[model samples]
Target: MNKPLSILAVYIITAVSADESEPNIEEICRFVAPGTTILRPNTCEQWVRCPTAFGAADYDDGSCVYGLYFNKDTGRCESIENVNCPYESNIVKNRCASKKTGSFLPHPTNCKSYIYCQNGKEINATCPNNLIYHPTKVACVYAKQYECELKTFPANANPICKAIPKNKILADTKDCTKYYKCNKDQQLVKLECAEGQSFDYVSSKCVTQKSAICHPLAPELEPESDVCGNADNVHIGYIADEKSCSHYYICNKRANGRPDRKPLHLKCQNEHFFDINTWSCRDRLRVQCYLDRCEGIENGYVNVAGDCTAYAHCKNGVTIKRGKCGEGFNFDERLQICSQQNISYVACKS
Candidate 1:
């Protein structure tokens, strides 16, 4: 992992001076409570001092001297032979939960962005142009006045990344489904869009093929299939999306939900799946989810997430005719008809 090449020392975030100009301690600090130290993963000597998390900003970073290593168990720097530094698996779960806290959450990987939450509505926002978000200040300030990296990987990198600026996402020249991200270390790493979508450069999102425009050399991908149409399931809770076990969403029902039109989106990491049974993220291998398309198919039959009875006819990507099938039948994709046959809830022939 590319880390700061600095000396080691005691870890103290609270005692550290309140520096409005410093960048966030590190993304790893987000997992710990205020005034605590967590061993920087894959590092032997570097340790991150976590801030109190007030305003979702501010933290201090320190490192163990060249010979000492970070010992998370004791929250101190110890000799390599005396320290047993293992990966803290809870970082992922805690990181996910931490971002959900407070009315405003700092963008974990983006320096100029933050999330604003109010009355159950969540909006991703960015600091105005020419300004950088200062978490402690809780406002946008001059980029020169604040010394912060746009992002950091704490991981590996590629030669291609050296040419790109940090925190920049660019489209892959050869593949519509793939894109590249430049890390804080100026390391370029290729990432993929969710299933059935292509990376949109204009909006910088993975959008449906109907609206997505990929690189000139890339072929077009299929349209996006979704499960956010039913009013009953809308605004209820987060539901697993089709084609990906890890991705889930709390969609706006009709416009995609109520008049509020707010959504909670989450994509589990480290092979985690949105476990419907327990209503949380779980090991993908143990939970079965998003196994078929109908659960989130937006057009024609089976229009809602996990609602087999409802059907929505989406015209020009807008719902026009949507309802349930007759009493004895459910929406069927195979025959594209409402039927009950073969004891499989199959579609009937004319």
Candidate 2:
């Protein structure tokens, strides 16, 4: 008797497990509306409105025929011929009309191309020339990789090209008092100097602008008449030489008596003139100078050898040495001396 009871218990457990795995069709169909039909048997989740003649009985037997779509308004299945639809009704067609016509969208695979959806399909388009399409901006713009040619500008002016010039000054557009310089490869780079420091155009460097004797655009020349000694007596430290505009001098307040004191006279070497920015003498090409004497040479001196092969270096208004051109060259005053080898030193008339 105990063995029979154990067998009965095993049978009951097996039946319960089988029922759990199978879905309940009757319960699923009870929730379905009267005019709707189940999409499939056993799995009674999907339901769609059926033709007026089809009912629950036909739906359970799977005898109801479904059309392309169901009309919720009419409570009936619809054939493709009976259905009327707009082009934008589909997802692809809608996106094509709205996104493609309204704005540009970048392609998922290519940086230079853009994608547009049309007629339930995706269309790819490319930007013009070397330009790239920017999705966020929705427009074709210049590519960052391309390098443009450099442009020229007048003195103390802004640049047109994106490329920055190496050591140049430009007044700040926002603030006239501030200035900027170009860094390597980066154009219109803002130069931030330390406190009390300012950009010097002559030197192409940064210097302390406060308490400086000479301003960038207009510099004051040192006065020769001050007799009082000490730093206070000196208004300007350097000034262009009165005798020769090509030379400059520094104020010396500690010399001689008051009112007749003289400043230390100085001259630029090798025909260079005073550069207000550098506060030193530089080549003629780097700085502009106007005088009757030859440029890049000391004042009141000439290339004694008329072939322009050599010249005399002068100091303190006197010739110190006979300067010679490099080997295999003759200095011609007309050719600006030592710049070219048009004439041989031996054959040159001196």
Candidate 3:
């Protein structure tokens, strides 16, 4: 199995906290309507029947009998002759065979597992616990440290896309807060507007519900368990992880880009980190993270990094709560209050 990773990245060298790459039952079962059947990462021999309740509880896990493999496309266990499981494995092996020594290759079917090429040898390795093998840092870390470029979809689910042009957002008639878009693949992709906002056709943007147009969502439109699968675009090959300063993955533009290589996760080696300016992992000291908006002060509310109306309540320099002021009110850094006086502050645009 491969280690897991999360999508949220903080630059403070804090503990890794995202779970996207984790093989936990909850993460795997997320985003789809209740009672969906899904595959476990990396293996086609077993499957997990998703539950109606969120997370790990109320789900079923089962495996195929000997000589049979679970076929997600078919939603059943079938004989090896009738499945692509072994063929996919062969592809993985062939990919790693031609890579340079010390190269890491991603397991095509499992986010938690990766292939390591060293000294003219290829080896299958799994990250420890919920940690995922980061190809850039070349180490194992938390989920919040990486994003899976792979988009996932239900194997047997009906297509969610409508007969619309690709890459355009369309308002839903059923739910004012939600909208749909056609992806590169012309799949009906659904998305939600931010809180208190609605998709407005007039302005073609998400705005306050009162000011935006809204329509009810259709009941037939089920949930997209894997948001990435319906995404308009994704980083295709070995790519830098914009979410984490220390992590990177192989999502090369051409998918595999090089036939001798494959998508894999990597992280900077010890005492090294990913430098955004240079766009690669470098010496630790070379990448200094001063992004904490609450860096040194020992308490109370503080203005967020770039928003004047937004503030964070801090305790011992850690943010306990975050909030935004109503329109016309700006955060008063000195008073730790939201006030109307600094509404013209030019620095809030970010």
Residue lDDT tens for model 2, 1-350: 12322332232223222122222333222222233333322221123333323123443233213323322223344432232211112212222332334344455335677766565345778889878776567777787743323222222222211111234344332322245544443234455444344444333345655433232233332333332233434434666654453577675443432322455677877546576556677644344333323433454444453344666565554566667788776655445556655653322344
lDDT of each: 0.50, 0.41, 0.53
- Residues 1-350 of candidate 1 have per-residue lDDT tens digits of 12331210111111122221222344323222345555454454566655664224555667877546566556677644344433221122122222333556566557788767554445678998878777677788898888755333233233222212234465555578877665454344568986446787544578866678675545655443345543344345566666566777775434323322334667877545577667787654345443432323355443334455555565543456667777877666456676664323211111
Q: Candidate 3, residue 20: CA error in Å? A: 10
The C-alpha stretches of model 1 lying farther than 4 A from their native spots are 1-157, 225-350
Output the better candidate (1/2) by lDDT: 1
Worst 10-residue stretch by lDDT in candidate 2?
156-165
How do these models rank on TM-score, best leading?
A: 3, 1, 2
**Of models 1 and 3, which has the larger TM-score?**
3
Q: Pick the candidate with the highest TM-score.
A: 3
Give the top-scoring candidate (lDDT).
3
Residue 187 lDDT, candidate 1, scale 0-100: 42
Model 1, residue 316: displacement in angstroms?
A: 26
